[model samples]
Target: MTTTAEHVDSGKAARKRVPRSGHARWLPPVDRPDPVAVLERQGRDRLPELLPIRYGRMTASPFAFLRGAAAVMAADLAGQPHTGLTVQLCGDAHLLNFGVYASPERSLLFDLNDFDETFRGPFEWDVKRLAASVAVAARENGHPAHRAHRAVRETVAGYRTAIRRLARLGELTVWYERVDAAGLLPLVRPARQPRHLGSSLTRARRRTSLQALGKLTEVVDGRRRIIHDPPLLEPAGAGDAASLRKIFSDYRSTLPEERRLLLDRYRFADAARKVVGVGSVGTRCFLVLLTGRGAGDPLFLQIKEARKAILEDHLPSGPYLHPGHRVVAGQRLLQAAGDIFLGWMTGPQGRAFYGRQLRDVKGVADVAGMNPNRLLAYGRLCGTALARAHARSGDRIAIAAYLGTADTFDRAVADFALCYADQTDADHAALGAAVVAGVVPAAPGV
Candidate 1:
């Protein structure tokens, strides 16, 4: 694989070669259509398309709401005047998507929890999305818009402050420092009436492994296979299972020689359909159980479908013709430590996906439990972490110069958040409308 420097240079050259005049502007124009209208249309369309992929497997809810949200956010962002500086964005930077997960080193760390929509785009888009999500979530929790606005403002301000501080750090310092599990307590102070914060932290700390998963998934005697649960996971057909078995062999070929050698120690024992994540619903995903020495010793791995980046329309494309490859490569570039099993392959049907371990001590914070103070601190941590990730691939000094010290960027993001939150509420109402009209089936207990 080419280096990150090469990728950035190529991307910049591509952007420069394109005609910058007229509608070809790198920054989107400010006078676009109502974001709410665009969001409503996107919400109605996304699920119908997904229904055929994994039919009758899920009881639909607002759970898949985030997948359809990308179009709404992207269309809204397209109307903004950006600084013409792009970085690899989280794409959907909702408060819930920022969370705690165990790193490869077995240390709990706070980082971006999802990257399905990740791509290179205007940095402000991420901040805007995050701020808007804070507003929406706060509103849903019954907080008034004024209080929600404060939360949104603080979140954006945190991003601005964090980025500026990171700009002052030495490159190595920025790369080496991460917000680890031990660091979280001081960051999120213990409240007299603590919400679910303590429990959430405890949940994140629990160790998870192949042994743990085996307990949750029983192996029937004679068959000796992973079983299924409705809406969460189901059994894969013989043909689909065979196809995966064959494709995994090819997948091994795509890895680096050393990684392939490392993987050879384990043999694939079984494969099963696995449902995962809110936004990633209906995408082709599977859990492959691998046994190393004996039946009792296993490693659970996930192969998930990779789709076109939501930011592709906004980015100057080069080097990355395949979006799946782009996701794998971009993830490696941005993350401090990635899954050692991380690799990509095209399946028998020519569909692309990425593979990694299914069971790690992966946990996310419960946003519903966070009070204003803790949320503010957590938001700062996310902002700081995001800056570090961006600095890994972009010119930090140039971005810092553009951002400066003024609160103008923060104010801009806050304005966008308030407007976009209204848009999301409208989109949510439209989704509820669809459910009422039976345009899309609604699940119980939504």
Candidate 2:
């Protein structure tokens, strides 16, 4: 095994391969692929009718566009030189993707919540994406460019500081590190902290399977059925419903024997095809409603189709053969605590799908409502959470060595973020133009 000193030396050596300051460059290559074309290619296999909703949501703002354009950014990052410090990346590590969710123990924890695009790659890719997102979000909230730069800097600094701290701990200690949701408030300036944060926490606590039962189901013909919200949420057809029931066993088998027993307590009630997320709108997604003991007992499980990671083509081969398994494994490895019901299985037509609870005290910060100070604090918090996650899967000792005690990497990333935010604005305009020319169909306001 490589000694600790060797690992630290290896990390410092990576700077020679890709200098820390080299990250600031962001000029697009002359032959760079068209962003619209990339989106069109992704939509090729998705539901044709729902593709419009994806485009419509993306056109709402540059930040929205960035959220939906992970593939585009993946390609861009692939073209750049990196530190070669590999980590299981939350490939789409934008601001909104990091949030608070409940562990199996029911304690709320702040961590990376989305994993549809998770894959292994250079650690800097995730950091760059996070920084770029901070810039885009700051611009969207009408913050000045200088303030955006400061926020991005703070983000990278947070990651650097956290990585160094974790490097000093034992293996099990580093592996068990987690960010408690209740501890988040201390990171923000007391005078600038918004009043809504407390209410947001309360709201997240209220967002349980029981709450979903009230909002998404009704008694129809003496049976509790998922309500239809058309184009967004629609009842599954007879064939779809039968297919779901048939596949439930396959998914159940993927779970641990103990978890299977817990799941057995609930009886399958109804299901619906639900549209979800900016990038995932057209993907095959379903919500299965299960009941336990009585009508008051409810459990909601989301089964989402899993495609290849957006960064797959850009990076080397990963361990998992199945896309769904890739997502589940990456989540388990990166998260401090994981969902008990998390599992993956193949569905109809041999498509990969992963299942987990639909709601478990989940909440995301309202980026739109945040002022510059609050956004800065939130960005730093996200940075710290992200570092904790990366430390779990990557070489924390080497990463800390690469970061050193200087702010060089932080400022370079902030510069790149500002430049890339401009690129995102241009790409957002390109998508808008395509919508206007009818080159792509867009169901605005959907």
Candidate 3:
């Protein structure tokens, strides 16, 4: 909560500390950490059997590599000069990380969905990561270099515009602002697309607990239980009634009294390991099923292990020793609307874990094969969302002023994104080379 800038002319002060022209600048001669070694260290805590899948997914493309290399980027970001303005960072603020999910009112809302790597860091760090992602994704889709740069510029412009607009409003107004599909459907909906948002929304809506149960579970003797698929959706050994009761109680204790009462209405039924995102493939992720009254009513909660965030060791440690609590706290602070089951608990072996709805209109957007113009539009949406998140958690007035009204910062960011994207490609290639040389184990085409 300390200001690194003078009270007056704060914008000028920030520019002086980290010149706008130097935003694209990176590193100062000394060699960087071995990215392969970093990956090896990260693998130590993950499920051993799933590490091959993680490597295979990461080896898919440069963009996938970036998603899995949060640790490497954190090391780099830590070495850079910062404005000392901190926010509750999503930590991995890539473009694909944002999505549409159902809010408390059942309204579809767009915001940052992944929070496993959430932590406190420089606000611009998140912005830079987002810009890099836009560039990387555009390149993956075979867009021209100029088009990628243009998209990055548009993203920065969107962030600037959103921050300036929010700065003019009251704190409460900024806090309440959200991106809703219903509000945007009329403007963004395309022709001949029968449903709003065309296919994406429809896919998300169909990802209900009942639908998941139908696909992933069946009658096991007298009771219905989850079907197991080795390495992806397997049982986490046999469950102990007392241990399960204790963990459930601990998770419930993290929620508000009202939320706890609401959860109490349902009885626990079954649970299974649920392999999720590319970066999180090796993590211990599981889905719990709860039933209420008739068999028709089913609720699924995803319980995911929370390790020390990628930013934890790089930045000064805070009061949160429990990573699950850190993730829950960061998610609540950044996202306007959060899950009703957003809570944390310490699991067996003292592993931190957080639980949320397995899927409630939870949809992830894909940027691959999108045209330059559409990619630019997607970039704008993500940038605006990032700015809103930072404004909620950081000194909004100072940040808005620092960015100013000129296009200088936007151009600088675009340049930085292009340059760092080149760096990411090199790093990604090194990872692939390492795998080929047997320095890193990998299973390709998974």
Candidate 4:
């Protein structure tokens, strides 16, 4: 197993996989699963009423559909020819999936924020998702086909260059490199809209804990509790208090000594059922409010239900034993730094869940308002971020060597993007047709 020649040839052997241009292929099996049935199956464990909301959002546009249809894409991608190179993938690596979040150091870092579907899989799976999402996003912003293609190329270029560069760095340097708000300027400056970057960063800085406390909670019964904005946000019901305590304790045990001590200082105040995001609309997500030393010192943690990653069924078996631990562990490996309180626990009812600060100056940069130049610039940043994430957990020499220096990989991705986007549009149309036929029961508008 440790033959010197084989060991030395590993990186070179990986490069001999499907040609860089082979990424241009996009095909679906004749008997592909109906997206409606897949969505319905995914909804089996979710709230029955909230499932419609998921449908409503997904039916909004092809881009929205892509965000919520990670399950469908996983199946399609499984059928593609991916080199055996694996990384901890953000199962749902859409354009919106990458954003600015606070690291443990309290500094804003731009990185992948959602890991609901994160798992060990081919690196191409994540890149394909990102490229396709960019294409759909360009359409949402009314960009032309040429501009959409250009955006995909930009993303691949950033990713290729970053992976290549990181392969040559010392291991520690690769591990420590990160992108933050202040560091975001240079990434997008070539696009020439520095004004928008300043405004976006300013808005993110304003979303502090105190600001969120004012917006999401109000005092009641001489104590502060999270506000109930019904349907979307409602008070947690009875019969779960015992399990909640166990969940909290178990989660605390998963943290390091310092973080556990920090968490121990806070007392749980209240929890409410809150629906969030496109794909996660129906999961049993709760916004848990905790008060620290003083009444005004508050912490809001989200306890989101963690089931099997949607990609797991399609991808090869992974290193994760528990899906909850899978999410937490994969996130730590990919992000430059993680939330101090990030942890996982299994509930008394045997449900798996992960806990984290609900927000950390974390805001999605709205792609709808941005012009083509800004979108392309943002595309590059997302690409570079993805490459860095891959390098952190993957064999950088193998991946980078496979990618090489040519733009062949770049153009292949652009081709793949356009093809998958068309497929997503068709799938979106099918969902819309179901809504019109009244079988899916989606809301009138998102």
Candidate 3's residue-wise lDDT over 289-392, tens digit each?
A: 88887567888899999998988888889668899999999999999899999999988888889999987888766578567766787788889888988889
Name the lDDT value of residue 177 in candidate 4.
Answer: 91
lDDT of 2 by residue, 199-252 (tens): 667788988999999999999999999999999999999988898998889999
Best candidate, lDDT-wise?
Answer: 2
For model 4, the stretches where C-alpha displacement exceeds 4 angstroms are: 1-12, 190-194, 444-446
* Local error of candidate 1 at residue 107 (angstroms): 1.9
lDDT tens per residue, model 1, 310-378: 676666664676556766787777776677777777875677888877766667666666666666566
TM-score of 4: 0.96
Model 2 score (lDDT): 0.94
Candidate 3 regions exceeding 4 Å error are 1-8, 27-29, 185-197, 239-242
Model 1, CA-based lDDT: 0.64
Clashing pairs in 1: none
Clashing pairs in 4: none
Error of 3 at 180 (Å): 1.2
The 10-residue segment of model 4 with minimum total lDDT is: 1-10
Each model's lDDT: 0.64, 0.94, 0.83, 0.86
